[model samples]
Target: MHAIEVCNLKKSYTQGENALDSISFHIPQGAIFGFLGPNGSGKTTTVRILNGILSPTQGSALVYGQKVTANSQEIHRLCGVMTETAASYENLTGWENLDFFGQMHGLSKTEIKNQSEQLLYSLDLYESKDKKVKAYSTGMKKRISLARALLHRPKILFLDEPTSGLDPESAQNVTQMVQKLAIEHGVTVFLCTHQLKYAEDICTLYGFIHKGNMLGFGTFQQLLQEKNSTIYLELRGDSIPPSFTPYQNANKIYKIPITGDTDASQILQGILKQGGQVYEAKQIHWGLEDLYFAYQRGVSHEISTKSNDL
Candidate 1:
């Protein structure tokens, strides 16, 4: 079953300008769906709508086939959200804050205490459990916020830039925790972030958005295929074959962009026949960054061509 679904989901402010255009997508259960875009691209807006923090201007979002607007209370019970700027009481200790939220979620006092201690230990914040939130570092506060979000043991998690200001070690820890939650607990994670590399690491599928429109949506392999981008090869050889053109590279190595896997075998045979010895040959796959730029470039080119045609 789809964990989250958005169809023609549009949101606008009083200015009548849409933050989320008629966007649509489905996040399968147990999948980490990466909502990727630059600042002001409507990523946060869409997340807010899904969480029922903000109402959609038109259309709707559904959680487990339940309309977000119609069943917001139930949706809230089933989802955990951790935003970058999570609000917490500065006067309260880390453990205290967690206990407070636990109670709000209807956990008994004993349950709250036990869960709070466990979360603090897991997040490596046990030492700072007694420390007031105001005394904690940015990373500490972020971790505490995450712990609070998970206190209720929600089935789905909405994480918006969850590791925005965390140190490398802390970020790694958080990423691992997120992966564990999804894999071990079957928690569906909806991650919204501008960190393409990080997103690539944790996300099972991706939805690329720009200017309030979803440019593409699929797994990494699917996106690569949709772009029809070439798989480049780096070879340390002399006297290249006639079929292969010089691609991007430097010293002692040459690169070639192959349109298909079959082309690589033919190129290899041609090189061998020409008495050229290849030291290293491997397919170079395009990453999320490359695909994102390609999408932007394609959009720009389309606009330019249309303008010229007009």
Candidate 2:
């Protein structure tokens, strides 16, 4: 079963203005799905709908085949959510906050102690566990919130800007742990982030949104068929093939724009057949950052060249 599924999900606060417009996508079990967009582009709103905190104006959201609205409490039990504004009780100690949330999740004293201590150790917050949340730094608060979310050992995680206040080291450790949970424990992670480079490293699937519309959704390999991506190979050889024109700046250097994997192969084969002696070849690959900007620069949802492939 799909970990999460949304069908033509739409939301509107005002009469005519839609916060989310006809967006549809699904995330597989144990996959790290990145949901990306600019501020006020409906990223948070979408999360609320999926968690059943807010109902959509139209369409539906399902978590593991359970309708969000009908099974809201059950879904809450299954998901560990760490939102950007997920706050802790300022008067409570770090340990107290975690203990309370753990009880709310119905974890026993033994489970809470084991889970909380482990998370505190892993997050580098064990030293400050006795300190009240009001005295903690922004980074410390973030870590504690994360620990609270993870106390239940939930099967699904919904994290929004999880690393916003974390230092580089802490961020790396957190990501590694999250990856481990997804890979080893079959935890489905729905990550809402603007950290494109970081997301590129960890996310297996991606969905980009702009102005309340889904620009595109798929794995990087699947989205290669879209127009925005062009893998270019610059070949310089002893004998430049006549079929391809030489690059403008360099003599005997030919630039090839490969649209697909097949094109790259065909170009190389034809060059060899024509007695072209390739001395050097440089290829430039388009990554998530590149494609994300490509979508941002677009005017509409028609970012994918292929009507159905991506």
Candidate 3:
């Protein structure tokens, strides 16, 4: 069963400005879907629509086949959302805040207590559990908010910039927990983040958005193949072979772009035959950063061409 589905979903504000323009995608069960985009690119807008915090101007979103608009309460019950700015009572202690949310979710008193304790420990907040939220640091508050989101054991988890202000250690801990929830607990994660490196580390699939539109959606490897950017071969040697065209790099390393795996192997063989000792023969694949620039460049080129035509 599909964990989340959005069909031609669109949203516009009062100024007749469309925030999202007919975006559509499906996330399979147990998959970590990374919703990537720049700030104000409608990533948060899409998350709000899916959570039923905001209604779409057209089309719809579904969680486990349930309509978000008509069955918002049911959708809420089945999903957990951790936004960048989550609300909690400043006067309440961290433990109290979590306990309150757990109770609101209809968890039993004993269950709420147990779950709160476990989550606090897991999030490394056990020591701070008794401290009031107003006294907590930004990282501490973020951790507490995440704990609240998971209190109900929701099947679908939506996290928007979950680690934005967290320290490196805390961020790594949260990332591991997210991966474990999706892989071991069979939870579906919809992660919206600007941190491309972090997204690459944990996401199973990616949806790249720009200017309120989805540029592409697929696995990382699939998107890389579609871009057909290049596979750079770095050869470390003092001498260059006659058969190989040396790239312009001042270092002893020579770089070449190969079309595919076959060409890569052929280049290696040719270098070996010419008595060039290869200290390093590594394939440099394009990362998410490369794909983002390529997509942005395409958009820019299209806009420029249209302007010229007009």
lDDT winner between candidates 1 and 3: 3
* TM-score on alpha carbons, each prediction: 0.90, 0.86, 0.91
Model 3 quality (TM-score): 0.91
The digit string of per-residue lDDT tens for model 2 on 1-310 reads: 8999999999999999999999999999999999989999998898888889999999999998999989789988888889886789999999999999999988899999999999999999999999999999888888888898889988889888888888999889989998999999999999999989888888999999987899889987776456356667667777767767745237876667766566766787788889878777666576677778777776313122221111
Range of the 10 consecutive residues with the lowest summed lDDT in candidate 3? 301-310
Cα error, residue 84 of model 3, in Å, equals 1.5
Listed per model in order, the count of residue pairs whose N, CA or C atoms clash below 3 Å is: 0, 0, 0
Off by over 4 Å in 3: 260-262, 299-310
Best by TM-score: 3
Give the alpha-carbon lDDT of every model.
0.82, 0.84, 0.84
Instruction: Answer with 1 or 2, whichever has the higher TM-score.
Output: 1
Q: Which parts of model 2 have CA positions greater than 4 angstroms off?
A: 235-246, 249-254, 259-280, 299-310
Name model 1 segments beyond 4 Å from true.
242-253, 259-262, 299-310
Question: At residue 13, what lDDT does model 2 achieve?
Answer: 97
True-vs-predicted CA distance for residue 178, candidate 1, Å: 0.7
